[model samples]
Target: MIRTERIDLEPAFVLHSRRYRETSLLIEAFGHDSGRLAVVARGALRPKSRMRGLLQPFIPLLISWRGRGELATLTAAEAQGEIVPTQGSATLIGFYVNELLLHFLHRHDPEPDLFETYRRTLQRIALEEDPEPSLRIFEKRLLQATGYALQLEREAKSGARIVPDARYIYRPDSGPEPWDPRRHSGAGISGETLLALSEERLSKRDTLREAKQLMRRVIFAHSGEKTLISRNLWRRRRSSDAA
Candidate 1:
């Protein structure tokens, strides 16, 4: 007899969903213990299907699936909590967060702490006026969990504590080092911004800006050629508002 795997009521979120064939749907889900997985939700697109409304992003869900190999069959899904109130730009920010996870996390790798971070970040984005801090912090944590942890509090080579007033070049993979005119080509960040990020107290206007730039550079450097659609949408929104 062949073996099979079955998961029941695993805490998860729907990262994405697309129509499969005529009535079924292909779903990408991120579970607290299961990491990222793909499942086929048979007949989920039908008018009377219970999952049509339940399988949406930013909604806390209890998902069940069964099968063998990379793709599984979705057996059941239920709401674990109320839908996250992500309106206006917060919705776009939530997508950006999901994109980051899709880009950084490998399938089948269990990251319970990162899952908690993702959940908390969504809650923070829904509640906070400035969602940048939450995004930056989430990016930082994701990087750490994926093994590219930022070296924020100390000099990369000299090993000295970061000075709040000094300007440094933040190298992807290598952390921050003293700026050198000809040697440094990485993102320029202030020591204060680095410190604020290290402490997870990113609130000040300047700190937020610097943190945004630093995280973007680092994420793109590691994520390779994949362009984040959510980020592009953000740029377009900013451009439209300016015009």
Candidate 2:
């Protein structure tokens, strides 16, 4: 496949960045049009490098780049609009989303819709008092966008729409299965919870809690070997807060 050079002022988010050589940076970013990309920011570590500050995660950017193959050179990056600010726990959750993008999304694959969804989620997280709802929604959408959408409304075996009051088990290899009253098991979850998650609506506190449990299992099943560092960090933070 022939790789193209020179992408101009593309809308993007910095997924991750690290030092490359003396003063350059290797940037992994999510571009609206170009998909996930690996970019090299020349002299980004210098004291006068304007892009160094702009390349941080969660900031919207319009950027230009050149070069081809596995990596491209970042030529210019301009901050777009006011940066949405996330504080404390919200900040941690925001990083969690970034970690998911880096792990789940394929490089050079265009998922413009998911990219836009991420932007909006950050914006909502900034204004919302509780980040849990946004986190739940993001996890659900991320899985769906990556082709791991759950069978939320129906059973894989019986092909029946989920009954809100009924108990069920979401098998990782299969999907949601209605629990038989005769055989009690641990995988059972509430159909009401499944419906709420499928519709991306968490009206009650229990719904939020259940949604987290569901997302954790789903994400863990498909995440391969990539560990969720943000989740671990958040767990530690919560423990410390509780202590």
Candidate 3:
């Protein structure tokens, strides 16, 4: 006889949660070994449910669950330890990270490496580190693990190595191609920026800014036509900060 797989006290982080029915919650959790999962935390909405406090984004949790359906039933949950608090821009950045996983990751797909990266990114953000670099690195890793790797190291047209002195435009389907100065009006970037991104070396402020624009375009093109709510909210916060 085959035994059903049951998880008990797994390390996880709540990515997002919503009210389900009258006294429960529909939770999207990122497990260390199980990747992304959707769970129903029964009675979690009650006035004194322990799960109510534990099921929060950016906090490390120890969660127990069972069953083999698309949505598992959460049995128990508790905070693993104290988590550093985030405020202002860091809070928005945390939400953005959660949204990225909820929107892009598929159910039941096991990605242990990505899970570790997520944990580290959150910790970094909580420490008030610059979120841009961490976000960029996570986005690149997510894309690569999900088979949407951006070919930034070479030219798409002639299979030649990208030269730092030239300029190029990144096409979602075809990687980067030489930028035609006379034809294109916008969306092209310097080869130096692309190279910097490929090397994961965004130390220069100009390179980081250019790389942000390029990745935004690439992510938008590949994410189809659906508007990313988190990205929009992030932009609004950024605008408010500027103002």
Candidate 4:
């Protein structure tokens, strides 16, 4: 007989959800301790179901589950507090963050610090007009938590500290190296941006721009051929606005 795993009142966020069978909902939850897992909410689609508007991405929730296999049954869900909705551009950024978690995290691997980072990121995005800084920071922390941390203050070669006035070319796997236009093919980033990102102090226009470019490249390099749907949607929206 298989022993069932059980968890009760675990702090979690609904990363994604979909219709399941006739009256249930399939949810992908990111628990503070259990990490990413799938749980089916039976009869969630019924007209008077208690979880009608409670199972949504970005909401703080306390969830319970039990199962002997990969997919567990969602036994209960309760909101932790008042819902603070992510609105406007933050919504897209929120989806982007969720997509990163979905792509990078392995099922059943729990990083409590990373969970807190994710929660803080959502709160920051909801409050800030320019959520790019939070997004960049989240990418950096995610990389660090998942064993792909970037070396921002040190050179890939020569073991030298980065100088703010100089320019460097960053390679995702190899870290940053002093830029030599004669040999380097990728874009050159200023040392200022690197240091700012290293310290998570991105603010200036140039620093933010370069940080965005660097983080995007590194994330894509690590993610392989998987394309982010939120990014594609944002790009399409930009193109439409321009047209």
Candidate 5:
């Protein structure tokens, strides 16, 4: 006889959750070993249910579940520790991370390292004044985890190490090619910026801006026509501020 797989007290975070039936809930949770999985939170909506408080997004949780099919039954859940209070833009960025994972990661595929990266990113988001660096790093890592990382270290055709002074056009499929100066304005990236990003450095304004643009383009290409709703909202908010 085969035994059903049961996960007990696994480290996880709720990505999204919705009402299921009258009192239960359907939760999309990201588990350290399970990647992403669908879970049913039975009777979580009842007034006295303890799971109700523990099932929220942005909170670190230890959850127990058992299942043999697509949706697992959530047997227990509790806070691993105190939530590091993500509010304002941090919360939005948190949602953005969730949506990205939901869009790219396959269900039940284990990504333990990426899961740790995500947990760190969330922790930083709660404390950082500027959340872009965290978001960008997570975005790049997400692409890499899903097999679409941009080549930022060297020229694609010449195979030469990227010079810090040279300019380049980031081609999605082919990587960064040296850009022609006479043909275009200073819209392409500077080698210094690319190198900075390669080293996970985002202090300078120019480096941050260029890296954001490049990463956004790569994400859009792989997104398969799905508009990142949070990204659109962010742009609109920026545009309105400018206006």
Candidate 6:
């Protein structure tokens, strides 16, 4: 008897891609069941290849691939449904989400929770809602799922309940620490901000700012030394929008 590889039509989103040889592409995709996978799209760079357009980021897709190595061969790909196109800041934010997954998530790791968060985040972005809140929520969930859960409800050192009026510093490894006035000037955040984050309320401007700082520190610690291009572009866009 001969053994044959199975081809699956899985719901997926493109996380990242790079040119493979001259006329093909290597794509990293996140699927509902198969999780993150690297698939090679042969002749994808050809002008007539339908895969060229179907593999873009933020679009839901039904993809069929074969083989079972670290990299699979793309057999067929099709757009799943109507995608509301995003532009301006929304578009950049979508790319930023993709970049985060591409950089942080391990290939072949199945994270259904993360997948659901990504889908919802894209939908929120498509509707032109405040991307910051949605992005931050997803970021928090992603960090939690990946074992870097942010302990916002208690003190890191004492494991005591967080005081809503006191100031605390978030230690990446140990959770929240009571702020020392003389040693650390800026790391300490209001307890109210921590409480707001615990409640997922991004409407408070101060809390949002502090949450951004905390998340940036956590992401930087885990993402190694390479900088995300999408983050740079998003920063430029934000500055231009402010001006």
lDDT of 3 by residue, 1-243 (tens): 644568999999999999999999999999988889989999998988887777888888989998776888999998888774878778888888888787778888998899888888888887846778777888888877777888888999899998888889888878988998788778588889988887888788888888888777777877775678887887887898899
Stretches of candidate 5 above 4 Å error? Answer: 1-3, 181-186, 239-243
Q: Give the best candidate by lDDT.
A: 4
Residue pairs in clash, model 1: none
Error of 6 at 102 (Å): 1.4
**Which portions of model 2 miss their true places by more than 4 Å?**
1-3, 181-184
Cα-based TM-score, every candidate: 0.95, 0.95, 0.93, 0.96, 0.93, 0.91
Give lDDT tens digits, candidate 4, residues 81-145.
75657987788889899999988998899989999999999998999878888889999999999
Tens-digit lDDT string for candidate 2 (93-157): 88899999988998888999998889999998888888788888888888888888888988988
Spell out the clash pairs found in candidate 2: none
- Candidates' RMSD to native: 1.6, 1.6, 1.9, 1.3, 1.8, 2.2
State in Å the error of residue 154, model 3: 0.9
Q: Name the top TM-score candidate.
A: 4
Better structure of 2 and 5 per TM-score? 2
Model 4: lDDT equals 0.91
Q: Of the candidates numbered 4 and 5, which has the greater lDDT value?
A: 4
**Among all windows of ten consecutive residues in candidate 4, which has the lowest summed lDDT?**
81-90
Candidate 3 Cα errors over 4 Å, as ranges = 1-4, 241-243
Error of 2 at 12 (Å): 0.5
For each candidate in the order shown, give its overall lDDT on alpha carbons.
Answer: 0.91, 0.88, 0.85, 0.91, 0.89, 0.84
lDDT of 3: 0.85
Clashes of each: 0, 0, 0, 0, 0, 1
- Mark the 10 consecutive residues where model 2 has the least summed lDDT: 178-187
